[model samples]
Target: MKNVTVVGLGKIGLPLAAIFANCGHFHVYGADINKLVVDQVNQGISHVNNEPGLDELVAKAHQKKSLEATINTAEAVSKSDIVVVIVPVLTRENGQINYQYIDSAVEEIAKGIKMGTLVTFETTLPAGDTRNRFGKTIEKISGLTMGKDFFLSYSPERVYSNRIIKDLSSYPKVVSGYNKRSLELATDFYKKGLNCEILQVSTLESAEFTKVAECVYRDVNIALANELAIYANNLDINIMEVIKAANSEPYSNIHLPGVGVGGHCIPVYPYFFINNGMHEGLTTLSRKINDSMAEYAVELIEEIIGSLKDKTILILGLSFRGNVKEPTKSSTLLLIEALKERETTVCVDDPLFNPDEISKYGVIPFSNQLADQIDAIILQAYHDEYQKIDFSVFENCSLILDGRNVLNQREIENLGMKYLGIGIK
Candidate 1:
């Protein structure tokens, strides 16, 4: 509670570190392998963008002298009372969750960890990993018993990017510890430190599954939405209108349709449970349905524009979730590849990312060209600035394909522009 070290200063980790520092209750040290990110945080400049209120919070944290960023993870761990791990986990080619970075973090922490310190894993993890994998790794490396020599807990990060700070503070936090001592320590720390309600579970495995369950439920729900969107297309119906009305029933709540499922947790966390979750069929099906959405968007474009040969398509967004710069699993990447395979010209416009970044991905960067006779505009992400853009002034495009369903069909049609929106007729 006095000194906090948050490893991995990425999207969620950076915000979490800032929040801890914002309270001014602890001196927080952020550790990351990226030297640039570390430098930026030390200078009070935010490395992540599109997150409202983060810049101000970071500035305030710096001004208070309560937050510091460093590339040395061992140093951060040695000087802190609480060590929090928030690294990325990915699937290998063999279909196993890659815990390489997580293991490395534990090893580093063991090297410099102090006795009686509280260690928490905030990353999404596979079931039984806390007890079978990470706990033993730390014990063996540090030559200290888990519950006796030090403390351990699994408290998964349940928030996404766009509203992460608010979600982190508002959502109920699921916390589980290896032992009673560890449990009470974690409960007290989060309860006093964060603004969220804490839910303490009996075991570390249970807490790991809690986060996985939340993400998988949304994946299944969104898969239902994506599947229905496709069915609505076949029937010439507006899926968005149907969803809005269907949601009027108190018991029914369907997720909104989009280009595809993106972000760090939604598209990736399901795999953590897939290998262990009892009911795997529905989970696999959901993954299949969500993964194909990008291709489906491309199909709609091909149908509208006929031949895409030498056609220039102006893409509106790049980030996975709208209004954010991070695109861990953004469907925009898939859409870009599909269009390029068909010889379609791709022009991307994302205020979050510059033209140089866009060009690095092998696509024509957005230059606000919307100039005469471009093929079509693909509204991939519905950023705030994209809302202010006027489509009526452009005449070159054959039609507008709204991937995220943010555009008004009537308004665009009235402007003499042909409009095609996701799940909209």
Candidate 2:
């Protein structure tokens, strides 16, 4: 692919465009509906921060004159051979995945894309979405037929947020297409720059289903661990230690239970298949169990402390996951609201997000005064920075609820503080 157009220059798309440009494999044109993101890209500035080494890659891509951006999709599609769709497909209110952004992007691409252009969607979607829905939509709108006038492919973007650059280059990329011709083209393009294993599958639907299954599998496993954790808690046993011991058998690899599952993939991906009638009962149950972990943490904390009214609680780490700047779908968000409703004074501290930005969530930013007066501390996110801190310093808090099990309970107790971790009675 000589020229590439990356639509939706957000988390996944920004790094994608940069990678293509930085590797000198493709002259990348990024198209986003957001004017601010477009303007920042054109000016060699990063519109989104928090992705490590992304700023440098964007700057280099701009300096080399290998990358550019615009809000106009027609303009980019007209000058590109590969039209990569990297938009976010979010879950709707009624438990269905919304593909509005992807639909809009494909329509725009159809308006100006040349014959034989590969329109590869890297976004996660339910099985048969790319080939049946998107392909038909583009053909209807543009008077083009799939596998004849244009080609469609599904190569789900598997890279995580902060580790995108590394993951893109290292992790095996899965690609599939509408036809053999499109499959070869997509695989060849990825092979040129990624320097990682590229797995070519049979159909676009296969690739789409592959991504969905990967995320759903993790969600189910994590939910099992959480269920077991709750069971262990009732029996006065430590699930983490049990997980450690069980893993020595080499067949049992139980994941750790946390406050709740979060992030773009785990919390949302299962709904793609769940709402589509693929064992909806089990998937929905697992999702509910994982989702309820946050509420469970809050309930346990409230029980440990007689009443939370007027008591000051400090929450460590604002991001959904540890060390990530992403706050979307964070269980901590729910925890914060639940705590506030109980009339407890809550303050949050995270090295990733600033206090002012965190205040947008309607919680107090952590301060020394808040810390000094903190009646309890909830270690929700186990960021590496938080792990490095001495747990004994927060000597004032009577109760310490370690949500991620990052704290040393005995050590905290030695400082005359009570430590209450999840899965511990």
Candidate 3:
């Protein structure tokens, strides 16, 4: 079996490790600086918020001697035939891509890697960054030349948090290398791990753009959905029904509207394409329109509040999307911040997120009978628990704002609550 080391064990890294280990084709090693995560993985438990059966898989891999977890990067890198870096390169507040985490990860791997060790970057980054910057940095530090002494490639992770396992096993894998040999090795590695088809690109930029293209396509389409939501509101038309009818034609494609685009990719990735020296004006405009969705949701809540300034606001979810507890760069968090700016008391409820998750945002957790105590309820995530909640809980004269369009309008309105939904009134 080939040895592989995966860095950054947050949402993406853990599953990649589990998949490799489960197949019994590779001796997988996982490294993360977070001691808590390392300890949990060592015990065959997963700290990831949404992935299922991960804890068991980690334990099984460990028991079978196919997988190991570590807090040290050099040890993991030195022993592996290939090293996959899955670190986060998020877009900061200034609308620029930050590479501090990625740079540090490369430095750590460079310390112990030897000749013939394949370095594959799986993070979503700007075009030409791998071949131009990262590969050179590692070569300088390790006293090796990429494509000659060692190998380099870029294969961005393309799976959502909630459905990571299924997507990884089923989704097509894209591989691109600095040279022909690097591409062949990387393609072989992925093909061994996943049963899906692997598409080899001619250059690293093509592979990088492939990943960005997926998220940007979704961002622009969601922007159109949000735009339609506002237009439908003004016309007093149910946009959801209109979309369902329009979608009846197979050629017509319509995305659902939400409070905003949350999760890690759609909200921040377009900036990677933009601020990294690409003409980001169009993407910048798309991001702005998508970002405004949260504020638009807050405005709807304010209109619902009209004259009730002293009333309570209950935010139903803090995570960006449902079925996953990760709140990193979530638009729901933005809405909560906006509500605080309005001087309204906010209480957040999410079955997936621990109550302490909102402490950083200065929002309190709600108790029993959340529906009866709050004057306005913002159904942010549409978790299964939220659906199980009786609409009568908010029977005492309040408004329910369904951000995810997961609520049944007639059922909610029949309970004497005014229902307002994105793209659906």
Candidate 4:
């Protein structure tokens, strides 16, 4: 059996390692700096919450003695025939690419890399970064020639958080490499390990650009929907109805509008394309339009009930997406800041986060006791728990703003509360 080391065993990396281990042809080593994460994985437990089927996969791999977790990345690489780097590449607030974590991972991999070892990167990167930035770094540190003494490949991770296991088997994997041999090795490895179809690209740059293009397309489409939603509001038309009617044509497709775009991929990946020295003006504009949506939501609330100062508003979900525990770049954060600027009191209620976690953002945690004091409620995320929530407890609530456009408007209005949705009259 081939030994495979997966670096940075976080959300995507841990599931990937478990999948590889259970494939019967590979024994996997998961490497991460977090000792708690390492210990949890070693005990056959998943640290990541809300991912379906990951817990069972990790447990089965552990029972078979095919998967192990460690903090020693170099030692894991020394024993492996293949290394897959899935570390994060973050974008700063100023739109600059932060390579600190991935650079450190490359440096560790270089220390123990041997000849003929296949090294692939699954992290999303700027186009040409797989060959120019990381490949050069490995060569400089290990004194090995890429595509000759060692193999280098790029295949972006294309799975969502909650459904990663399903997405791995469902979507066609994109693979590319520095040379012909590198491409062949990567294609063979993914086909056997992932049991998925492979779409091979000519070069590493093409594969890297493909992931960023997917993210940019979503950002731009959502921006268009947001812009149109505002226009429909002024015309006294419902934007949801407009989208449904317009999408009946076979040639037209439109995305939904929200308070703002959030989460790790959609909000951050656009900057990777913008700052790549490509002078992409439309991408930059779309980012600004999406970023301004949280403030726009604040304006909508004010138009319904004049003066937010000294009023208490409750936000439904802290997570960026529904039913997920992750809060990275969530739009509710922007909403809180805007409300704070207006001297309004913000209370947050998320079934995924406890009171201590909610208090970290400097907002009151909503409870049934505080329900009578709430003046307004904003449904930022439509978690399943909120679907059947009893709205009668909030006797003082004057308005319920459906940021996701998922709430029942007539039911809320019948409960003696005002119902407002994005672009809905």
Candidate 5:
């Protein structure tokens, strides 16, 4: 079996390592800086929550002795024939790509990469970064020529959190390489390892641009939906109904409008494209529109309930998306900040997070006893747990803001609470 090293071991990385190991063609080593994660993986446990098949996959890989985890990334790379780097590349507040994490990963790989080793980056990057920045770093540090001594490829990860395993098998994996030989190696490896269909692009830049373009399309479309939602509210029409009806036509593919768009992918990837000196107008404006939505929700609350200065508000679901624990780029963070600025008392609840964990954000952890003090409620995330929530417990709540537009209006109104939803009249 060929030895394969997978770096980062995050939500995506861990699953990827496990998948590689279970494929029966490779032995996988997972490397990460976090000791807790390394320990968990070595012990055949999964630290990532809400992933359906990950725990089983990790356990199976461990039991089969096909997978190992370590904090020493370079050591793992040194023993591997193929190295896959799946680290994060975040964007700063100014919308500039922060290359620190991915740069660090590449530097470590450079320290251990040997001649004839295949190196592939699955981290989403600004287009051409695979060849320009990271490939050059490897060449400079390792003193090896790309496409000669070492093979290089780029394939962006295209899976969601809860259904990563399924998505991996379902979606056609996009693959690209530095040269013809590198492309052939990458295509063969993924074919044998993943057993999934591959869509090979002509160049590394094309593969990188594909992922960013997907994100940009969603961001811009969601911004359009948000704008239309606001306009619908002014016209006393329900935007949700209009969207459902319009989407029935073959070409109308409007995404649902919410209080705001959140999550790691949609909220951050646009900045990668924007900072790359591409068309800055639409992407920049979409980001501003989505970012302003948290403040918009706060304004809606104040307009309905009159001055949120002293009112106690409770926000349901702290995670960026429903049913997932990650809070990266969550709109709830922005909402909390906006509410606190107005001197409003804020409380948060999420089924995925404990009370102590919720308290870390400097907000009250929601409990039944605190319900009486709540002046309003906002459904920021439509977690499955909230579907059956009894609305009557918040006896003093005068209004319920359905930020996700998923709550039952009739049921909330029956409790003598005024129901306000985004773009619902």
Candidate 6:
């Protein structure tokens, strides 16, 4: 069995640690800055929200002595032959790439790592960051040559929070190394942990670009759907009908529109690409369009909520996407903030979140029995709980705004509820 250390205990890092630990081929040590997180992991408890079998895995690994978690970076690094960094690269308010966390992690790993260690980064960053920012720092700190003395690589984490358990093995892994040796090392290690196929790229930047491009492509397409949804509203046309007809051609693929885009990668990765290009004279129209979706959604929501200022409004779903506890850049929260600012009384419901937990948002928790009390409702996620909803449950709801087109317009409107759906009449 190989020895492995994973830095960061957040969404991407925790599951990755479990995969290696469960593989029966790795002695894993997980390191995180949070003491509570470390304690939980050591007890075989997972703090990653909505992750199944995680607590059991943690308990099992800890009991087997194959896995452990610690706050001491030096101790974990001292025992590990391979290190995986899964930190986040958040876009700053000024549209700049924040490399502070990444730089800090690199410095820590440099201090703790031994010679001939393999370091693989799973953080989303601009192309050339590993070589320019991390590579030089490691070289300076450890005074070791990267390709010869040690190995460095980049691999994007493709697991979405809701589908992480299934997707970890179902989706193809995209990987690249600083050099051929580094690439081979990562490919072999991942193949052991995952049931999925690994696609190797020549350069670290290629691997990084592949992930960023994938998310950006989705963002641009969703923005197009959002923009078209507005036009459909103006034309009094059911955009869903038109889109279904267009999709029947088999060549024209159209994405569904929502209140706005959410989740970590789609909203953040494009900034890394766009900001990096600013230094090289690049202006991207797609990024701008996607970024403006929140503002557009806010405006649309304002117009809808204007008439119901004094009425209680129910917003169903809080996560960035449906069925996940990840609230990073969730458009639903954005809509909540906008609605709160307009002095609208908001009642929120999500199967994944507790009412007491979200009480500070000046909203009440909506239960199955309470959905009928609201004057208006906003369906942000098409979670299964909401999908199987009976139209009679919302008989008292005067208005229903479906960001995800969750409700059937014919049924909902026929029940005396006015429906405003994305690309649907």
Candidate 1 achieves a global lDDT of 0.85
* Model 2 TM-score on a 0 to 1 scale: 0.94
Which 10 successive residues of model 5 have the least lDDT summed? Answer: 271-280
Clash pairs detected, candidate 3? none
Model 5, 1-425: lDDT tens per residue? 89999999998999999999999999999999999999999999999998999999999999999999999988999898899999999877777778888899899999999888899999988888999999999999999999999999999998999999998888999999999989998998899778899999999999999999999999999988888888998898999999999999999999877877888799999988777676569998998888888898888888888989888999999999999998888999999999999999999999899999999999999988898999999999889999999989888999999998988899898899998888884
Point to the candidate with the largest lDDT. 4
Which regions in candidate 4 have their CA more than 4 angstroms from the true location? 278-280
**Shift of residue 32 alpha carbon in model 6, Å:** 1.0
Candidate lDDT values, in order: 0.85, 0.86, 0.84, 0.93, 0.91, 0.79
lDDT of 2 by residue, 199-302 (tens): 88998889999998989888888899899999999999988889899989988888888888887888899988887876557788899998888778888888
- In the range 1-425, model 4's lDDT, one tens digit per residue, is 89999999998999899999999989999999999999999999999898999999999999999999999999999999899999999988797989999999999999989999999999999998889998999999999999999999999998998999999998999999899999999998999999999999998999999999999999999999999998998998999999999999988788998889898899999888888775568888889888898899889889989999999999999999999898888999999999999999999999999999999999999988999999999999889899999899999999998999999999999999988887885
- Ten residues in sequence with the least summed lDDT for candidate 6: 277-286
Q: Which stretches of candidate 3 lie over 4 Å from their true place?
A: 278-280, 369-371, 395-397
Query: Per-residue CA lDDT of candidate 3, range 350-409, in tens?
Result: 787666766667887877766566888888887768768876766564688998888888
| TM-score-superior candidate, 1 or 4 | 4
Supply the TM-score for candidate 6: 0.90
C-alpha RMSD (angstroms) for model 5: 1.1
Error of 3 at 341 (Å): 2.5
Q: Looking at candidate 5, what is the lDDT of residue 321?
A: 92
**lDDT for position 116 in model 3:** 95
Indicate whether candidate 3 or candidate 4 has the larger lDDT.
4
Decide which is better by TM-score, 1 or 6.
Answer: 1
Weakest ten-residue segment in model 3 by summed lDDT:
301-310
